[model samples]
Target: AQSVTQLDSHVSVSEGTPVLLRCNYSSSYSPSLFWYVQHPNKGLQLLLKYTSAATLVKGINGFEAEFKKSETSFHLTKPSAHMSDAAEYFCVVSGSAGQFYFGTGTSLTVIP
Candidate 1:
């Protein structure tokens, strides 16, 4: 079985501040991890993905995540927060069976 967990349901940050969205996962075997973001009234878009390639994966909008197998974590981070970055982020994990598990989601609030 595979599962995805987003530690924070909501996160607030001021403009120019660093952003961190924690995510942990569990799987019976090596799992593929992905981060998706949904802006207001917009469709979900892939932020990044980890598919057993480089441990450190970079995504759009200056976002990146490191796959730590020992810790079973793939936390997302950004050097700075922008007003446009405010949105709902989802952490997803997929198993070899082609089944995908999604986290509840984390709402990011960017304050000026």
Candidate 2:
């Protein structure tokens, strides 16, 4: 079984500052992890993914995440925050059985 937990339900960041969204997962085997962002009334977009190929994965909008097997964590980060970055983020984990587990979600607010 695989499960994902998003430690924060909301995150606030100032424009031009950095952003961080914490996530943790549990699985019997090596799991596939991903981050997706959903803008208001828009579809979800893949932010980054970890599929055993690379420990550090980068995605759109200067976002990135590091897979830490020891800690069972895949936390997302951005160098600078933008107002347009305000959105809902989800942390997902897939187990070997092909079942997907999603975190409740984290609403990010970028303040001017």
Candidate 3:
């Protein structure tokens, strides 16, 4: 079975500081990993995807993650936080049905 586990249900950050959110995944086969960001009342946008080709991947909005096979983890990081970055993030693992299973959701709060 392919599954994704996010270490945090919520993450709070201050404006201009670094942001880190943790995620771990498990899959029977080689996996496809994705990070998606959802703003308020908006649809999800693909942040990045690791398609078994890259160990380290970069995404939109200055976000990035490294796919660690040993640790079974893909953690998202950003150098600086912006108010616009305050949104819900989801860790996803691609499944057999051409679908992606999402984390419960991570709410990012940006303190001014």
Candidate 4:
């Protein structure tokens, strides 16, 4: 069984400040992880992905995430926040069999 947890259900950050969205996951085997962002009335967009190639992965829009096996975490971060960054983020865990488990979802609010 696989489970994903987004530490904060909602997070607020000021523009130009650092942003951190923590996520923890558990799985029986090595699983693939992904972060997705969804804007208002829009579909989900791939934020970043980890497939065991690298411990740190960078994604579009200045977003990145690091895979930490020891900590069982895949937390997302950005050097600075932008107003456009306000959106809902989702943490996903995928098994080898193509089964996907989604976290509760984190809503990000960027203050200008």
RMSD of 2: 0.8
lDDT of 4 by residue, 60-108 (tens): 9999999999999999999999999999999999976898999999999
Please identify model 1 stretches exceeding 4 Å from their true place: none
All candidates: TM-score = 0.97, 0.96, 0.95, 0.97
Q: Which ten residues in a row have the lowest lDDT in candidate 2?
A: 93-102
lDDT of 2: 0.94
Clashes of each: 0, 0, 0, 0
Q: Model 4: what TM-score?
A: 0.97
Q: For model 1, which pairs clash?
A: none
| Candidate 4 local Cα displacement, residue 42, angstroms | 1.0
Question: Which of candidates 1 and 3 reaches a greater lDDT?
Answer: 1
lDDT of 4 at 17: 100
- For candidate 3, lDDT tens digit of each residue in 6-107? 999999999999999999998887788999999999999999999777898999999999999999999999999999999999999998878887877788
> How does model 1 fare in lDDT?
0.95
In model 1, the worst 10-residue window by lDDT is: 91-100
Task: Flag regions of model 2 displaced more than 4 Å.
Answer: none
lDDT of 1 at 88: 99
- Candidate 3 local lDDT, residue 79: 96
On a 0 to 1 TM-score scale, where does candidate 3 land against the true structure? Answer: 0.95
Q: Model 4: which ten-residue window has the lowest total lDDT?
A: 95-104
Pairwise lDDT winner, candidates 2 and 3: 2
